[model samples]
Target: MGQFTPESLAASGQAFELTTAGGCGVFVAEVHGERLWIHGAGAVGSKNLTQDGLALFEAMALAGGCRFIRFETDRPGLVRLSKKAGFKTRAFVMEKEIKKC
Candidate 1:
């Protein structure tokens, strides 16, 4: 929403906008290499992202010939959405090195 900036989007690639006439939501995707990544997604006054959002992603993948899609967000709700949309989660480890000898 208001959190995005033209400069930020320009950094990723060419900028564009699409509104779903309030029936869905607004999302921005940029083609990275051969994949289109969701740069932003939002539905005003809605707690959950619109189903159209999912469709938009699907359409992009199909059009771009993307065989895989990757997304990560800090929002737990989004994680749930991803799961509901047929995604699996994998646990990973983070190790830090302590150097003092």
Candidate 2:
């Protein structure tokens, strides 16, 4: 697992941490117009990671004062968890690396 520094999020003023009885999660979010965009998240590997992540999403949404929340993930587990948390997949993202000339 990677290190979780809540200080980093607090200093940026664009992120927050959410802790529940199950576990804890760190998320970076920003309010864009009418939406709360969750840039990324990280948490310890545990059976309750999904639940913790969902809780974090809700907290971020409420704090951002946005009705819509958006985030992207490539991890299959997270995809499933997000769906279970009532988030629908809107689009798929693809990327390619450019070779230096």
Candidate 3:
């Protein structure tokens, strides 16, 4: 959700609308070679995000010929949820904020 916008997603990724048992939302994914880079997903404020919804996106990626998918998130809840949905941690991400001190 941070630094991602409609313009940005439209610029370089494939956008998908989703309707699930929970509710409706959308996601943006881009094919980075054999991997589908899931840029962002939004089903906020409705209790509408579910595993089925995530799987729906995954299905789309597979049908589009992606061998795998990847994304980044800082929320613990999201990480737990993704793990439950069979997503594994392939690597650790580290970052630091630079200041012109």
Candidate 4:
């Protein structure tokens, strides 16, 4: 995975940043059909990370006319927060690297 700067995200016109009193979050979103898909996001490791992220998601959904928000993350803390935000696991991804001579 790669990290994105707020300026870069803004240049792409598909992402935004949410800054709260306690922390800040970066998110990238896309509207497809009736749902808003959050391709990626990251927040400073603070107590308000979850709050900032959720608020950003809601704002994007509202502005984009999307009925739902979808995103993926492997962080355990985020997993727990996602559950709190009413998200359920849909699938798991596994990968391995192969070396060639």
Candidate 5:
């Protein structure tokens, strides 16, 4: 079983949208304005994950009142999954962490 710790998610600028029973897997997100960014890896070939994944992602965007839902995944399989769920690759963003002295 896997867990999506709130502390870790929050630190990563993400939110936990949903999780499976017995701590199987979780659907996490990074909300920016109206965007709910999801980054999850569930059990292999789990049908529940496939269905719940799409629903959860859609719900995230809707709950945030977003007109568009965007996701980024370098994994070709994951990208295909997102595309099937009506998402498209838009632009890329390069991020760098800053530390305060």
Candidate 6:
């Protein structure tokens, strides 16, 4: 992921795994107040990207004491699926890369 690496996640103890219909995959969790942030790897063949698998990740977040779960993504398919899964768009994140000057 552009925002996180395996090394960073492993070092921070924020990495978690889920068992999907296809296989298994990983997710990263960050808790803020009662809210939890998590997302599954979207890369194909990475496994656990299915809906049931992702739901397991959400369940983990809630079980970990988070009342809300949030994740950032730019994928249209994922966005649609999330909406079907009852996730509402709370905010939009915009970014501009600042090149070396």
Q: Which candidate leads the pack in TM-score? A: 3
Expressed as tens digits, the lDDT of each residue in 27-50 for candidate 3 is 788888888887767764343465
Local accuracy of candidate 1 as per-residue lDDT tens digits, 1-101? 46657567556654444456545455556666766677655556443334556656777777888755555566787777777887666554477987999
Residue 44 error, candidate 1, Å: 1.5
TM-score of each: 0.61, 0.71, 0.78, 0.75, 0.59, 0.73
lDDT of model 6 at position 47: 25
What do the candidate models score in CA lDDT, each in turn?
Answer: 0.62, 0.73, 0.76, 0.76, 0.64, 0.70
lDDT of 5 at 88: 77
Higher-ranked by TM-score: 3 or 6: 3
Cα RMSD of all models vs. native, in order, equals 5.9, 4.7, 2.9, 3.2, 6.8, 3.4
TM-score of 3: 0.78
- Model 1, 41: alpha-carbon shift in Å? 3.0
Candidate 6, residues 1-101, lDDT tens digits: the string is 37866777666447766554566666667778888877445444432365765586578777989888888888887788788888899999999988998
Tens digit per residue, CA lDDT, model 2, 9-47? 555447766666666777787777877777657766575
- Of models 3 and 4, which has the larger TM-score? 3
Off by over 4 Å in 3: 1-4, 45-48
Worst 10 residues of 2 by lDDT: 4-13
Whole-model lDDT, candidate 6? 0.70
Q: lDDT value for candidate 1? A: 0.62
How much lDDT does candidate 4 score? 0.76
**Sort by lDDT, best first: what order?**
3, 4, 2, 6, 5, 1
Clashes of each: 0, 0, 0, 0, 0, 0
Pairs with steric clashes in candidate 4:
none
